[model samples]
Target: MSTNRRTFLTGLAAAGGFAIASPAVLGQAKPRVVVIGGGAGGATAARYIAKDSAGAISVALIEENEVYQTCFHSNLFIGGFKSYEEISHRYDALAKNHGITLARARATQIDRDKKEVVLSTGARLPYDRLVVSPGIDLKYDSVPGWSKDVEEAMPHGWKPGRQTQLIKQKLDAVPNGGTILMIAPPNPYRCPPGPYERASMFAHVLKASGKRDCKIFILDPKDSFSKQGVFQEGWEKHYGAMIEWLGPKVHDGIKSVDPKTNTVVTGFETYKDCAFVNVIPAQMAGEIARSAGLAPAGGYCTIDPASMKSVVDPNIFVLGDACIGGDMPKSAFSANSQAKVAAMVIRGELAGARTFPARYINTCWSLIETDDTVKVGGRYEAKDGKIAAAETFVSQPRESAELRKENQAENVGWYAAITADMFS
Candidate 1:
């Protein structure tokens, strides 16, 4: 094996040894693994552990909602490429097919010392191992002049479900020649490509709705964004003069927002009387993780890149957007990939299953316009104690129509496969 690969495997073996040596409670009939959150990370981890264990371990999945509408494809729903039902998933199959227990309650707290999850329904669910995949919680007050009370007027739509539909409704209500201003979040946010995709989707809706005069403005705090070239090309070709992106250099910085007046003041200029505003503020790990003292400094849990086990507590694993994933972008595919690693390590530690070296894969696809999509992804390995990128690929700008269409197909196929992986 290569030097990096050898080092990576050695780290995995050492982490596995540490997990195996973790103190276990006595007098248990079956080792119980409790997973928090039912999104891509927690759902995939729960399914894998339950299925691969083959009745050797019990898996309990704790989630607030029974039906999950994926944030990954919700942009397509906003663009009218997919329906709400297409992005929605239920956990019934996970219970029936995989023999996993679905606990339909919000996780209020994580008792690290007691090894239990406190639910909103005043129940304590004990576990030998805890998998926390509660995705990001929006910092509503992070953006100036924005807060939870004004969210209805200026929707974030970062979390899937009601916000997604609300944003779609707000977009539909925009009059012809109206303006929509979207405040993109800063760095280290979930789905690095998301804000740009949402802008594309918004443009798609306005263009297809015969509102050619409608304009969408993305005020980004970052200098550049994911698939910038491909998205720019597609926007220019399809929505010509309909979209604008103001980087920090151009916008200076967001000064303030007035929800009642539908106005936003930036350091350089002020946008007045906007028809709609998407204020996606800064984000951090879900509230449960923060409340549990799992997130120390970065507002995210630090985990061993080799095993996805928390550096704070070896028995608790963090997945998805809640953990620092080294080089991995906080996307559903990355979460699902990390979930498998956590499941493998958990099985190895608790069920005496053989373990292998950790290898992670992620592909993020963004639909630029109808039948036009771009992708970026890579294979990753634990190197130098971080999940470092090994091999990477991305769609190029000015690709042929056929190639873009094929990429779009791949995007659709991946959504189906991943949602099935998580919920089915």
Candidate 2:
């Protein structure tokens, strides 16, 4: 370790459990970084900044949850291909190994002018830089007659955690020959291919459970979806006639939902007697971001494509599903990529580290069946004041079986690597 790192470690050891020490007490200024949220983007950002800075910067991570269950690969858990425990990750390593102060409290407000974060416990944390990556919040009312109270009957399962378990329970309890109704969200939502991947998972569980007569209906607001050809081909090959996708032209629009009777009233027709329902409503940046006035008309935080700094507040950096990443779809991988760019910029500004041009990459992998996977991704860079796609690829229909298996294996490997990068 360098002399600067040794001095940093000594300061941390002297400060005890306190991640940030007063300038008067330390006899020098210690730049502090406060990060909110512990998901893909937030966790990765916190770890990289704290680790690469080598304790030169005081880092505090605020997250309400002790253990985080990833929204990524959650469909595999629901499909019985992976266990819930396998997808769940603990944050102890981040604190113990990376020297991040774990503030197990919700951040109630962001005082951007003051450069401080107010916690639910009424404590205030002052920071030189703040990273806000609280992810997406579902707009329950976006779909008429739907809210949190009625979510039990028609769980979105979009946020992971309890909703994920509930959806799996509902899926297992679904009777043979039952029909499942899924209302897919519009464009610019987290994980563009998530709902369709979930549909495939539901089909897998039903088929594996010998409920061959069970069927699913996907009502999408958009005319087309991510990897439409690949997903359609995979569904036809594996699910046969089990799944049906209806676009806006067919469903007209979702008028209302009666969760009590498991009914969905669309502009075209009324769907009643649905055995299970998953309604992924429109989304916005999390409450903290909205309350801070960081988001604009699009309901997402807009940032400088080169640095990931919020347009509204230079001291605040936004990441993941909450930020409007130009050509990059809102996915965990995209968020992780953005986090690194933001971290590099912050370090360059605060720690005098060398800065480089921002380059980003993202790949979204969706499993359609056992050993059948499809993907869409691209390389991105800061160009013309926006994150522009440089190169892109997508899985095509009628690929070789070996190639499909390889894609599935690659997905599994990525999950392992990314979770380690975030929490371990």
Q: lDDT: which candidate is best?
A: 1
C-alpha RMSD for every candidate = 1.7, 6.7
Model 1 weakest lDDT span, ten residues long? 19-28
- For residues 42-156, write the lDDT of model 2, one tens digit per residue: 9999999999999888889999998899999999999998999999999998888989999999999999888899999999999988999999999988999999898888999
Against the hidden reference, what TM-scores do the models get? Answer: 0.96, 0.93
Candidate 1 lDDT by residue in tens digits, 31-78: 999999999999999999999999888999999897899999899999
* lDDT of residue 377 for candidate 1: 99
lDDT at residue 243 of model 1 (Cα atoms): 96
Relative to the true structure, candidate 1 reaches a TM of 0.96
Error of 2 at 255 (Å): 1.3
> Which residues of candidate 2, in runs, are more than 4 Å off?
1-28
- RMSD of model 2, in Å? 6.7
